[model samples]
Target: MQSMSTLVFDADDTLWENNILFIRVVDDFLAWLAHPTLDHAAIRAVLNDVERANAKTHGYGSRVFLRNLADCFERLNERPATEAERREIERLAAALVFDQVELMPEVAATLADLGARHELALLTKGDDAEQRRKLAASGLAAHFGSVHVVREKDLAAYLALTSELRLDPATTWMIGNSPKSDIIPARQAGWNAVFIPHPHTWELEHAALDPADTGVLQLPSFTALRGHF
Candidate 1:
């Protein structure tokens, strides 16, 4: 049997559908605004710009996303957006965080199997209440021994969590899709990492992993983790 270890997972796209829901809201908002001069791609660029900047200043969550959408509308829309349009943005944001999202294939089963042998935990970055809401909705909270929500998932935060949990960097593993947040920083923090790439991960989370990132394992899917752990 493999040695028992701590397995920390990232919540959003790493475990379940997240950005896709936000994408839907963006598409809906774009449709409503229908910028006269710009097509969807051009219009979305404005929103993307807003998100990237706002993420630095405001951090992240449904509320921030909703605000980003409104801000983008005001920036791009030739005419002033009506209160109805603003309300619609709020509705979409509420629906996303307030409802249960579909978990990735084999997530529950794989987490169950791993949790049986390894100490499982969560290290995800986002707005605290929204992340908690998503975790509570996911129905996999019991599998985790601890959960951490942070404003950012940089190397410092990783180090903080490692110290907080008293985890052995040699034996603990970080499992998730975001190369920027989950894989890179965790490895830099001296933890083992397993990368399960998700096609729908947020654009902001994309970062190329160092080809020589030692102790980093890439798997085909979440269920494939059963083979390694």
Candidate 2:
């Protein structure tokens, strides 16, 4: 609420299209499988399970996503994949990882507006190289005071960042799409949180906020965020 507030923005869905890209890749995989009897919903459910399990072991990014698709197919089919099928999956995953980063509508103007008014920083979680690549490609990097790439978005991670930067929790704000990662953890750290919901937010990133916990401010979209400042 203060003019000098330190604002941390999540880089993925908050600034650009991330989860939707993964969804598109998954759809392509389903089409390639072409299983007449298998329900798409069931396969997606299995794929989600595989992704979570594999994330714990292999961590996140394109390679882990490819492995998840491969493991899910094998689990459902009860057989090893053919060389051609493996190649197709690898090609699709590579395309996704290497694809140009696309910013959300009005993101550039919105970030520019906010950057002029406050201390803006980027706080994103994922493979360091992948996150940096996306950030660099976004072309909005110059607006930020600092950029942080973390393996996870949790209370401890935020705390560590704040400590290192010497930011006061009382005057800092975290703005992002994920309630599980962006809002809750920021609020828990005694900082302000603004939730900007994205349609394709990953299921693993979803969480319900208590009605009594009215600290988090929810906006319909990123463009609307400029009004708050």
Candidate 3:
């Protein structure tokens, strides 16, 4: 709808390889724990447990996940890690926030084109500093008129954006990777939503809904979004 004036995007998986990087690092750490002295299955179980526990307590994002991983490593090893191992783990953990982050193919081009015609905003949830840094470093900061980095993705946050922007939900669309965090909530808030699945979405992020469930639209990629609006 050309008349729709505001477009809000979810920043993490929607635009880049975020959760996948953390999963990769966790897989690497699990491999390291397969040493003769460690129980591989037990270690993996503990890591999964820690992740579930932390998800409830700390919420999502690379920074919080890394901290939980570090604590789990120390507890499982029953001793402080060697300097080399510590450095390695820390490096892997930090990679989610920094390292090599490239925009998904066509994301920049799509956003640039959309920015010219609509009021583009980023509504993301993460460690405030890390999310801001990623947006800035990815060269996406200039395209968005406003960026909201919140601690959690909830009804309140969605409502706040509409209120702050003086936008009617009927004319604002939310584009994101998570059905739970983006699609359902946007629909509930009376806004349209577009779901573009990322390859490495976490289980927590999965929420099933029929295409006819609401006004939420599901697309395979950002490049396909132009035709939807």
What's the C-alpha lDDT at position 180 in model 2?
Answer: 92
| Candidate 2 Cα deviation (angstroms), residue 224 | 1.4
Cα RMSD of predicted structure 3 = 2.7
Assess candidate 3 and give its lDDT. Answer: 0.81
Q: How accurate is candidate 2 locally (lDDT)?
A: 0.87
Q: How would you encode candidate 1's per-residue C-alpha lDDT over 143-178 as one tens digit per residue?
A: 998999999999999999989999999999999989
Counted clashes in each candidate structure: 0, 0, 1
Please, what is the whole-model Cα lDDT of each candidate in the order they appear?
0.88, 0.87, 0.81
Q: Summing lDDT over every window of 10 consecutive residues in candidate 2, give the lowest-scoring window.
A: 91-100
Candidate 2 residue lDDT tens string, 1-229: 3477898999889999899889999998888887768878888898999988987777778878889999998988889889988898898777676447889999999988888889999999878888888887888889998999988889999999989889998788899999999999999888888999999999888998765776788999999888888
Which residue ranges in model 3 land beyond 4 Å of their true spot?
Answer: 35-45, 74-88, 97-100
Per-residue alpha-carbon lDDT of candidate 3 for residues 1-229, written as tens digits (9 for 90 to 100): 4764689999888887787777788788888666566576777677777877887789767767876777788788778778887787878776564634678888899988888788899999878888888887888888998889987788888888888888888889999999888888888788888888887887677888776666777898888877765
